[model samples]
Target: MRNSTLLLAIASAMLLQAAPAVAQNNVPIRKIKAVKPTTELTLLDRVESDTHKKIYQYNEYGYITSVMEYNKEAEQWVLNTDNSYRQEYVFNAAGQCTARTAFNVDKAGNKTTEKNKAKVEVIGDTTWERYYKEYPDSTTHISEAYAYDKWGNRVEEILYGYDGYNRMEFIRSYKKREYSGPVDIYADNANYTSIERGRLLYDLTAKGQDDYHYTMNTNDLYVDEFRKVVWQTENDKLYAREYGCNRSLEITVGSIEREMWKSSEREFILNADGTRPVRETIRSYDETGEVMGDNISHSYTWDNLGRLLSNIRYKGTSSEISYKDEYTYADDYAKKLSLREAIAELSCGNQIYPEDEFLQFGRIATSSYNYVADGDKGESTYEWNANGQLIGGTWTETCTQSGPDNDNPTTVTDRGEIRVGYNADGHMAWKIDHSITESDFSKIEYIYNKEGVWTSEVEYSGDSWDGPWTKEGEWGNARARKRLATRAATTPKFIDDLTDGSHSIEKHDGVWNTYGNYNVTDGVVTGGGYQQTLISTASVPANPAYNYTDPLMPLEREEDEDAEVASEEMWYYYWNTDKGDWELDWGPTDAQRVYENDGNIVADIYDRNQTIVSTITYRLDDDGRLIEETYSKGGNITYEYLPGTNYLLESVETAADNSRNVCHYYYSKHNYVDPTGIESIKRNDASTPVWYDLQGRRITTPTSKGIYIVNGKKVMVH
Candidate 1:
């Protein structure tokens, strides 16, 4: 996703190139045209109706120097006074942008006030940038300097900020690199060094605080081997530390040779043929550095053709089996078969394929059993079209119980079937799932534009397969393809109005029943009402408020009554270049109380006048996973993750009462494959070597002097 503002600027540049030379003094000036809504099957179209026109001035070097936006009111073009609507730029002799200033303009197109300015200077291998913003009484400035290596890698950076009267250094970061090995095996010259370590220090006293001032230090270490990072460690002063290791080994199991790789927190034993891992194990540890309860492992069975046949999971040192799954595939087909026939055959314990010779080696059924339970099992049957698309399927679960009081075993079953339809473009058009046990059904239908791009999706539910259906929800008009842009739904209310004497409802036996009502006084619900029966009545001291000493809160907190009924919410999106997607650009809204900073919802705001609701503060790891969350109302939750993986090893939640709840999560994988490739330059073979480009395209003869692969080795061509 591209920034809409930057796209507008680029569009202005294009218009300037096509503009006629009719301006005074032959200056290059062009009007910014209204960008039409892109009809290229984009999920969400811009609301172009509110688009305003702007004029851009270009220098002789074809660089944009100034931009002024206008508003058409009363059939006249008036200069927009908004600071963001006008900008000026300065360029150096090399056509490099040196300074950018944004200011407010008067009706006469004269700059009235300087809002903000940024200037940059570059010398040899170093660069400096300064930013200034004007407030009512004082102007604050921030300065940053960077030093880069010859290979264009940043080696050091420093930041300073003005503290009203004096400038103070705030942060310093340094990078360490070593040139012992090639940085890129595919490049013409791979002599550059790689970053091996880094350190960052923060001056806590930069903001003029002495009592709470202590420099914070962060260190990172990266160990590279075989052109890949094999070990990494991070330490945050005396706060926390973590390390990760990745390695591979060759071992023999019985008479078969196998490859093994420790991936993150799990160890995988690959198959002898190097196709996939036949076994995996995950072990966890406690806070005291002792091994926790049991180690989870998964073993897989595959056929000669590399097809999975069965997978079994085990736990603990005793090797207690947990669950087992078996798969069956069709080997040959004589003719095409109907979906009903295929499902029926698989359900009857037959793995026959279609008779029309449509598909071969297609998985037909899978059965899973829980070994912990005497008679708990599930089975799924699938029917696929010639296009290899799943068209129909059935899922069934069966449970059997027998006790001393009962001589015969009783069996219960729940079954469901799903059917899918695809459009001519091979996109899913509709799908329906019918629950045989409950005699209910739900369906989703997709709508596409003339260009065959999916535009809308609607879900409906019905009591039976033949009755009238009720619309549950609809999502459509996504600006980013396949991402939900808007959703509208009319859902049933679970709780009554929050006014005095309001009660909550619970669904029981397909009917909603109202519970006891609650007492409300002064817009705050009292504790000794119906809520007491549902929750504890104990009261704890209010949680500590969020630290506002840093002046980092970008939005003001407001107090309002919590709505118990369904309400609509609107979200604004901004382009995230790192994620290559649109992310919510959040602010204070009636529907949202959380504020985001650096891609994290760091704080929750509550109205001071209303009841003191819990405000949550989050702490994240380097990978942006939540590690700890503290609530101002009395409890905190901490998560222990498997090193270098998103999988959680354990989580502890402490309530306001100081009572703690601990949970452990176990993970297992079957048929995992380790990446295989040569990470170093290899000697070329004697035979005529094959040449290929970086994109893996074979080259008949070298016509250009560049990097190419010869005999599986990358080499520079002269």
Candidate 2:
């Protein structure tokens, strides 16, 4: 879930502030509003710099009239001499906010009005309608329109796209109906506090359509949410949503049997508390509401204090599967005391009868485990330091590896202990995971920058929080993250990874420029490097209307995240301090990127000195999910859909050899197995002379020059 928060620095401030309370009337489907924002805000003043500030002047009705920016120097408040920006809200005599205009201020204190892009009209109390306009090229064009009800709930939303003649045309539409439920239940489910007595979502919106036309719906309260499909089918199929209480979803056309009408039902059992959902059973049904297959069930057991004790799974009618989990805790406060044990006694499966005569009855199964709670079993205790940090812990559990059945299961007692050390800033600086069975210990180390970002993470083995910690697994690097640009992380401005070595830091003084170098390796603050970000000359908008806390700040997409930037100049490095000095010794390459509206990079490439080096373009499905990506030098890689009608990726076409200067990329989401250790990879059993590229590609007799992994060893092949 943290991966989903990779947002732009421009909007980063918005996230730091508490979001506006969602109206008790109804929670909108789209988190952010499509229409322009209102100048009306409870907070009237915003401090941008130590000396620079913005003041908002509002009317009696609480609508901002005009915004003013000022500078305070030497304890004196004066108009900013270097810049002038202002915004004024225009209202009709009827107290209707018609338009908000932006103005540019001259050094002489004269003001000139620019375009009035935002327009909204309150049509009676219950209906507020507005047209969405885009200023892609400094010219405004109608892009969307929507209306909201009196309770501040959006009832209708429609989008438009430019036609061949540059005229806007209708593209998609969405509509939501109002329904009520119990207030307490609604608030808990929606994860909100303080709802009016009425249930905000007493009846939930079962199905909805996105701009791409793909549809998704849920029959049970939360099952569909767990497995929502972005696109309706494998083939490029589109559908519409029929909104109502019955909430049955039907494909507009075609028999992509998967997209046809379907529903999910969930049954729940509760503990004595009556609130904790201890057991849940989910069933799948066809359009006719007929049971399509066997129902899967999950039961959870919890301690008196609400800590989960064990989890169990059941098949078809009350048939217990081998899958179960038993947890142990040191105390109520020390939550993550230790990983007690994971047991898989037998494989779990469901007997399925062939709906088609072509196939016979069979059972589908996957590796599973069962856990039984016995006296003194599944217990773990942890010790805390004087500072209340988890220092050490011990775990004991009875584990059974997958076998034929639970009746004749081979149960094994597994025990392990962990020792952890923390940094001055309270981060787990070092940790040792001991496996009693294998008599082996796995240790992990972490490092952070001044900004408290976990900039480096590494794993190892053999010692108790000490190394020969030389077991290098995944590189810990937060090079792409931005804080105060001067942080050592600047070394990563050009490089796309977190690997440490010799890195050049670039500062953006109004514009990105090469600054200095950082020599930190694997998170240890090593050689000197500058830590500072240059002042952005374009820090504030040119429009005077936004001089008072720019409301459009959240909408400004960081150009870097969207497309291959057409940079005038770019920094490239070719050296690292990973012992081999195989890092970016050669500095600087000019490149640019292109992106979609919401900061999704579509292409990355550069036309350097009249000779184009390479270009990699990402292709996404209609639902904005990545499916294929093509490179100018490397071959194409296409992706397939998840098998069970989910909107997630299965295995995708992986790049061959990244060291070859060919593009090796992953989509926004990664489901690939982590290659932290050799045991994780089931290497090819082929006896053919094995050689792999740096990016882990099995190749023949060292074709092109570069470093190759031959027989599990790194070898140079130049």
Candidate 3:
């Protein structure tokens, strides 16, 4: 929608230009015919009504000055609401709203007295508000200040509270630069406007830090087309930042250079597709801009949609690490099988774009191979109903093809059929069976608020691990778009992948290979979406019997003192109830994550329970930097930002065993504001919906209770 104020500003500019100049510094006033000052536009009093009447007063410049809501009470005019009924506005020389004051009234026809009205003031780009509360015997007041830049982006904020003594209560600061451009979600393209900084403070003890933010303009996100935001503090360090980025749309070579700082610079080269970085080179330099240390490079491979096929990391010129993950579609399974698995059958597709779309309310599978370590191989299967809803799947992995038997003594892990059930509103109510378990599957249940936004997720390991699963974590103050409430739970099916055409307990995980690790990543649905990765320990597991206490958890052996430490991660997903398919968001809310660790990231164990020995909770500042880290164990750490930089963490507050903690933060911004897109759903996909009456008989027009599937969604009929 077009902005009203913007339109008015354009009109005003045009009027001034169209005016005829009578003299060097004056415009013709059309031989002023005004009789008196009264003829000029002052506050125009007007009243509007719908269900209730509201009186509006506007200034000569067309700014709303006051608003009063009223109703006729017993044939007499009175305020519509006893409180919060009237508001007055004040403007600055620039015609910008400078202040706002709110007034209240009482039941006895008493209006707000001039003395007790509450007001807020905006000086330039900063906002200052003083809130006062009335009590029978005393009044309390609190003041807050927020600073903004010329672009109207908030830069800093502070709050002051009074108790026995008046003092500065709290503060937050940010560095921001914003830009405008087009963004296209369909093309999966975004161009970002970023503001960031870091500083070495004057006191060397207390630093004044500012956070930063950025947004993307997706239309051909090449070259730098953003405003530069520079912030400085009066500090003694002589700190200077040299950061810049350059790209080429004109060049035939697909490459870019980004110097985040003198000592921190990186380069990326796109693949033939020119959609994503095919190779990235990072180098650290000394003050003289000479290579100071090891140079690292990352090589990436992708499909036509820019989906990553493989990624390899190189140190200097030596290959340090390399891995390949391939994909196969459901319809292409036959061709893939004919290739004798020479090309790993794509399972749970590894392609980056719309892995869910490959399902097409059907099934997709993936297999992986590791040449470096015992050639570990593994595969996973997924099934989606006609509604594109994930219903069940299986996975199998082993260290050695012959066995985790006598010699290799590795873990042969398998998981049974995993099924999901959803509520009527389409939100996942609960999903049973683990992705890694062979049998006696565990379950995870989800709880959502009235807004259909998931609030809590609990785990139930069944009688195998723990009795019943309990709430693990919740969405902390996260915001979401409004959606319908979840409806009654229903089951969707993956008919194609079913061996017996039945989703039953008889199904077993298909063991493909013995090595390699599998990971599933997705974006979280919330404000400021962030990417989250669920990592499984490449730390291989030990062989276990069918009734194995921990299928993925290897038993600690004597020689295993320095064995690959294990860290397990379990991920529970939700499908878009309305669409009946897995939903995707911008990113995950990493702030609310709970970390329980055994200090073993190199273990073969993927157990969430029992291995955890330490637990910590983290909170991020406005700049998305870790400002606080609280542990279940006694102590915690607090962080302060560096001057000028939006994300650089500095001036740490650590418990005296303090050796001057060091922290650094990087900033990247995403536009949460949605743009124009399809407002209605397209339901033209081919689907043969089957209807069955309550008595289990096929029915077209049911006179009795029945359930039917249209497309992939189920509809209740009676």
**Candidate 2: tens digits of C-alpha lDDT, residues 1-718:** 0011111211222122221111111211222222322333222233233344443333222223334456667887677533334444554665445655445556444455453335565566534444444354544545444554555554444444544344434344333334222222222221122222122221222222443433222221111111221212212222211211122434322223245344665555555545345666666776576787888777766655555565677666576563675555444442221111000011111101111110111111111234433222365556656554567777666665545664665667878887877777675677787878767788867645435545445566674445454343221223323444545643434332345777665544322334666565685434433332212111111101111222222121111111253333433443344542223333234344343423333433444332346655555556444555555665554444443322222222333353211111111211122233332222333333655455333355665655555444455554
Q: Name the candidate that leads on TM-score.
A: 1
Poorest 10 consecutive residues of model 1 by lDDT? 547-556
Error of 1 at 308 (Å): 3.3
- Candidate number with the higher lDDT (1 or 2): 1
- How many collisions per candidate? 12, 35, 45
TM-score of each: 0.40, 0.36, 0.34
Candidate 3 has what TM-score?
A: 0.34
Question: How many angstroms is residue 29 displaced in model 2 relative to the true structure, after the best TM-score fit?
Answer: 19
Among all windows of ten consecutive residues in candidate 3, which has the lowest summed lDDT? 198-207
lDDT of each: 0.42, 0.40, 0.34
lDDT of 3 by residue, 403-426 (tens): 445454555555456677788776
- Cand. 1 TM to true fold: 0.40
